[model samples]
Target: MRTFQHKVTINDMGAITIFGLGAFFCLWNRTNSLMVILGCLLIIVTIRAVDRAIHTSYVLTDDSALQIKTGRIGLTKHILLSEVKSVEKRPFAFHLGHYALIEMMNGSVVSVQPDNVDSFLSALKKRIEKKDNEV
Candidate 1:
């Protein structure tokens, strides 16, 4: 099994912190309860997103077949390597962050965002090559 793990980048942290602080300050100064509630929700969302970003990891295992697993939200997705048709790194758009599109031969696509995009791509490519060689 080969594993690739990465934490949220400093840049991501800084952005999240700025957003959280802004919401907190707005909540503190606002007199409306609805505004305050919205601010609180925003803060919660930001924190959760940051935590997930930092904690997410991916693992690839080679047996008779290949298995890919991604960890997040106390759950892991197991995918067979033979099912994967291709992997493509797409450009960051909006809040999506850097994404890897795992295209399956059956025409299913799974989108994943890893903290260190370059390393994730490299590791995925290596695993794909290894799986292909085994076949």
Candidate 2:
């Protein structure tokens, strides 16, 4: 019956480093300047996307509702507690860094990267269990 909420911050060191190296390479090897510039831009955009993903927060209430808020597009999605068919805690996967995927009854999934995923999963499970017992 606990309201669990978590927010995760994006770490930009990797992106920044890649962009810097790409810039350096672009200047040093002018033969492929366009490719290097494109790589750098791609890295920058990837960083921004990751930042948006990480900045998102998830809120789970005792009523079985899951709410997510992403900073970039100012979009918030709410999934009813009964709508979530399953909650899966996935470890760091390919290109996912480290995040969790919540699957809904409709077969749609939402990804969330919380700072403490283990704790988040534990709390979510506990709440769900409690709710089930109440019914």
RMSD of each: 4.2, 5.1
By lDDT, the best candidate is 1
- Judging by TM-score against the true structure, name the best candidate: 1
Estimate the overall C-alpha local distance difference test score of candidate 1.
0.70
> What Cα-based lDDT does every candidate model obtain?
0.70, 0.66
Residue 121 shift from truth in candidate 2, angstroms: 0.4
Model 1, poorest ten-residue lDDT window?
Answer: 64-73
The alpha-carbon lDDT assigned to residue 46 of candidate 2 equals: 57
**Can you write out model 2's per-residue Cα lDDT over 1-135, one digit (the tens) per residue?**
333334443344565556667656665676766876776776666566565545667777656877776655558788776666788877653544556788877889987776677887787777767777878
Residue 95 C-alpha lDDT in model 1: 50
lDDT of 2 at 123: 76
